[model samples]
Target chain A: MTKMHMVSALNNALDIAMKADDKIVILGEDVGVDGGVFRVTENLQKNYGEQRVIDTPLAEAGIVGCSIGMSLNGLKPIPEIQFSGFSYQAFHHIKQHMARIRQRTNNTMSCPMVLRAPCSGGIRALEHHSESPESFFIHCQGIRVIMPAGPYDAKGLMLAAIKSEDPVIFLEPKKIYRSFKEDVPEEAYEIELDKANVRKQGTDLTMISWGAMTRLCEETIEDLEKENISVEHIDLRTLWPLDINTLSNSVNKTKKCIIVQEATKSCSLSSEISAQINERCVLNLEAPIQRVTSWDLPFPQFALENYFLPNKTRIKNAVKKVLEF
Target chain B: MAQEQIGQFGINHVSILDKEGNVDEKLASGFTKEQLSEMYYYMNLLRKFDEKLFNLQRSGKIGTYAQTKGQEASEIGSGLALSENDWFVPSFRELGVYLTRKVPKNLLVQAWNGDTRALGNPNHSHNLPISIPIGSQCIHATGIAWASQIKQEKDVTIVYFGEGATSEGDFHEAMNFAGVFNLPIVFFCQRNGWSISTPTTKETKSETIAQKAIAYGFKGIQVDGNDVLAVNKVTTQAIEKARSGDGPTLIESITYRMGDHTTSDDSMKYRTQEEINEWENKDPVLRFEKYITNNNILNEQEKTDIHNAIEREIQEAVEQGLSVEKPNPEQMFEDVFAQMPEMLKEQKEELLNEIIQMSEQNNNGGNQ
Candidate 1:
């Protein structure tokens, strides 16, 4: 095992998948020569040649729609949409065709493809560059949503996404692309989707989050431990097909919980988790469920990005509020 | 600015048979009597199917249907040009193409009857299900061809859409990709004059839809859509060019929609009777029939026999479609995913239980 970043881990996963399966192809804008804007797919074109790693014209809907076609023709395509914000251009294909093809054809055909998009904030870029669009995809029934917080999870989840028989929206948090590193295995492995990983088991308040926010929650919990505060932390790997059983079990033990997310609080995945907990673990609660999330306002530019994101302080404040109650 | 011609592009329109049952002597030898007769037979079959399905919709036997009354030559000619290995990507109104491809007539009826099972992606067929959304299948055609090219497969892909579909962004995207990648695909746009109520002139200001391919850096040809021979000739060349790795080509078949956009639509609301009557004079089936008579390919007795045979086939297909069992309601919950998610599983169970309880209540009412 070697220390790797999220981008490299994802690249390795693509390489491994492509090597094992000749049908697997990678397509997106600037994904071949430029190796993507973030260089996550660096040198893939040279290694896999132009046919396997294609640099398609700048068209999100076309990229996705064509990927669905490739899937129907028995090719496993992993199409990247540049950024999560730009995926809106492909929402029609995603919602209408990609998500509906299997059910539309009634089991005879499946779009066994993966749509990879960089999601969420922190690296303050231009408008429409750093917004979390996971909430939009999580609402889609036929598509699976997989978001990874670190290198290990990113590699494993990406492999699983590529192998899945149904279409998957694999959202890689751009915030943590190079923020840290972990000793990820070089071999191909799969981390189960719809399962939560308990980062730190505590009997007190349960803190649940995923993607970039999960890392922030881990840091917040680490600092809280210095102050003699024990926090049960859970990283939700897959947002949809949510591990509600693990969530409610933890919520019941802690008797209080705080859900954190980088996306806006309105109609976010946090609201769904909060509601589920409220219904399933209602009698076990000692206080109302807390949601530490960004305000409903648009993601600000770099100058005021700290104000819009759910930082450690915000998460800690929610934890203290839940603990005091 | 001086009136200097910097560059020029030409659009060729081909027609082998004229309206008065006269064929160009030079092209007449290229087709045999049997092939010409087969074209007429398929054309007659498709028209009969169209008339039958429209009547079925009127009697509430089927859901809303899209009629291909006047565009038969464009669809059938292009479909016939394709080999069995080539993929046929279609928009909703390619009934003539499907019939020409020999897709089960009963399956078409079942699909129009709102049965999803009829549309299941059949491994045995080279055709995809009819796409209701406009212009989406264009991209799929490019991708399918690209995959075939990557695998070094010789099979070509032919995608059919109408003139209005060219307005969609997906069309431009697919065209650009096919041009850049040199994919083995054919973009067959039937310029049928109307996209629902909108005219072709309203769709674009360009002289012809065929010219749109020039901007994408590929060859585009225009054909007389009313002339089945012309459509077959152009499509055969385009398909051959793709199979030989010559890249993509766009063939714009100029035709007219003699029927309404669909059963629910009324052409009289948008077009004049004069225009409809003028187009009727150039009817593809009638022109082909005239050719068969003038060329002495089939006598009156043989023509009558072929017509009777087509009508019998249509009747049998309709009966077969109606006789099939209605799909199970629970199937709606399946096929969404390889493995149903917990949420869908719960909903499916809930629905099944509800159906059981309702049946028990009906039984109690029967006892009373």
Candidate 2:
């Protein structure tokens, strides 16, 4: 095993999927000879031929809509919706057809495809470029949604997403594309899409999060531990179809759970999990399931970003509140 | 198909069949009596189905249905024109043609009844999901068409939409892709005059909806949609052209919505009584019936018998639709994806248990 960044991990995952299935194809705005804006798809076209790696026009609907057709025709398509925010352009296609085709068609056909979006804040990108819209997709029923927190998880989850029999939205955290490195397995291995990994186990309290938020919480847990305050950190691999068993078990042991997410707190995935915990495991709770999430406001640019995102201080305070209660 | 992909600067209408049960001998040679009769019978069935479903809506048995009254000839004729290997992609309003392609009669009723389960089978042919948002299927059709072309398959894709859909960006992008790649597709538009309350005149001021093809460097046709013969004629030529490697052809079946856009809509709100009367005179089904009967192809008795048979069959279909067990409200959770995540499964179980507990309490008749 060798350590690699998120982009390298993604490259290895594509190498794995493409090698396994000849029907697998990669398409996006600049995914062809130019590799892609982020170079995540670098060397794909060269390895697999131009027919498999297509450089589509700058039309999100065309990219996603056409891929649905291609997938229906028995070809596997991995479409890149350049930026997470840019995916909104193809929202109708995804939410309406891509997500519901299997159910609407009564399981006679499945749109087995993957939509890879480089998502979330921390990258000082364009206005719409950095946004966490996993909650929007979680509201949709038929598609699998996952946000990988690191290089290893990205490699494993992307493979699982591609191999799955249904549509999956694989959100790659742009902020962590090159932020961290870990030695991924030399032999390709798949990490399940519906399970969250235990980043650290502590008995005092549990901190649940996904994507870039997990890294911040991981850092916060380090400092929190120094003050004799221990926290259980969970890196949610998949957002929708959440690994509630793992989350509930941790909440049962710790007796308190704090969910951290980059999206606004209202009507978010965090809200769904909070409601579920209250309804399912309310008796075991010590205090209310605290949420360390973004305020319900349009994400501001760099200046006020620290005030918006859940960082070490905010998370530590939430941990302090739950402990005191 | 490439041989027929000629760049026409104006309308390229290619019709041979006429309203008076007449056909141009040159194009008629390809069709047999059996094929034409099947199309005739199917179109009749569609008209009858529309008649009964509307009545059911009035009686509150089924939900609203978009009438295919003046557009059956267009849908039936065009759908019949495609080869078996070719694809048929349609919007929600075109369920009549979708049924023609073998979407079950029960499914048609179930879908309108709010059971999306009605649209559940595709083993019959290449049909995309019924699109509620107009014109979106056009791009999917184009993509499927290109997939065939790229793979060098002897197939094509035919997309159906209304004239109002031309205004959508999806329509523009689909046409652009069809033109650029010269994909084997037919952009079959049913120009049923009215986008709900808005008339076609307000939808676009273009001289003809078919003329929009000129913007994308392809041939376009303006057909008298009420005449089944004309719809069949242009559709056959377009299908042949696409089969021979010609790019997409835009055929605008110029017709009118003879009934309300849906059961809940009031056509009187948007169109005048006089306009409705004029289009009623040009109803596609009536035009075809007049042509067939006046020519002695199908006598009055034969027409009555067919209509009676269709009505009885539709009644049976309604019974079949309603006869099923009270739908599994739990179906809302099943088949969401190929598999439910453990959490959803548990959530579903919890919901079921909660319902069971509620039912138990309600049996005591004081749970409110």
Write model 2 residue lDDT over A1-325, tens digit each, in one string.
9999999999899988898888888888999898888889999999998778888878898888888887877788899999988888889889988888777777777779989989988767768877889988987777889999999999999988898998999999999999989999867899987888998999999889999888888888888878988898898898877788888898999999999988889999999989987877899999988898888988888677778887877788888889999
Inter-residue clash pairs, candidate 1: none
In candidate 1, position A3 carries an lDDT of 100
For model 2, the superposed segments whose C-alpha errors exceed 4 Å read B1-8, B14-31, B122-125, B150-152, B293-312, B315-319, B350-368
Worst ten in a row by lDDT for model 1 chain B: B120-129
TM-score (0 to 1) for chain B of model 2? 0.90
- Candidate 1, residue B272: Cα displacement in angstroms equals 0.9
The clash count of every prediction, one per candidate, is 0, 7
True contacts kept of each: 0.69, 0.65
lDDT, candidate 1, B276-363, per-residue tens? 9999999998998898887789999988999999989999999999789999988988888888777778889999998898899898
What DockQ does each listed candidate score? 0.72, 0.58
TM-scores for the candidates: 0.97, 0.92
Candidate 1 CAPRI level: medium
